[model samples]
Target: MCDAGLKLPPNNEKLQREEEEVMHGANLTLKLNFPQYQSEVEELSVKSSTEVGYVKLLIGQRKGITAKNIRIFYNGTQMIDPMSLCDHLGVSPPSIDVDVYINLEHTIDV
Candidate 1:
């Protein structure tokens, strides 16, 4: 597992252009579901350029959990921290509504 808080400089112009292109004409929304908690479903309005790890941090603050303890899943798979929300959704303009599951269980190594 990689550090979720790692930050990288935008050294490639092509990547920046691609990111802007995906976010050009759409509003992104991330619907977060917490199965183990009673909190009502939370929705985050974001851009396609938004990072999944950032969303996890926001969820952590709202739920009183550490950001490292939060795991985001889209379409039943874990999301990489550095990937943008749009890439994870794999839509050209991205869906206005994106659903992500929040897992709070901590992993243990034997």
Candidate 2:
């Protein structure tokens, strides 16, 4: 995926007429989602939460791997089952590519 290369939003107190129109137009537009394979995501697990594809790419750019391989593990032991990897990772299929969802990261649930 290409980086969104999104620019910063205008500060609320200083929007010009043109800036206001652009911001409103952007808000009115729709976004699309792209599906990802469960098998593909599952294949990259260094213990579910960690993805091998991500690691491989990182390693290729860093220390290095000659075989171009990936492995899964539960806790510290090796795992071959996709279910095992997914169970720990909670991966969902047909994932959303673009999100308009609100961020709840800093919100307290209690």
Q: Whole-model Cα lDDT per candidate? A: 0.65, 0.32
TM-scores of the candidates are 0.58, 0.22
State the lDDT of candidate 2 residue by residue for 1-110, as single tens digits: 99889888766654664565343321121122112222222222133233434433443343233214433333444433323223344333323112111122432333
Clashes of 2: 1
TM-score, predicted candidate 1 vs. hidden true structure: 0.58
Best by lDDT: 1
Per-residue lDDT tens digits of candidate 1, residues 1-110?
77889699769987887677655534666766665565556787777667778877887777666667777777677778888776765533434333445443652322
RMSD of 2: 19.8
Q: Pick the candidate with the highest TM-score.
A: 1
- Please estimate how well model 1 matches the true structure, expressed as its whole-model Cα lDDT: 0.65
Off by over 4 Å in 2: 1-50, 70-74, 77-110
**Candidate 2, which ten residues in sequence have the lowest lDDT sum?**
26-35
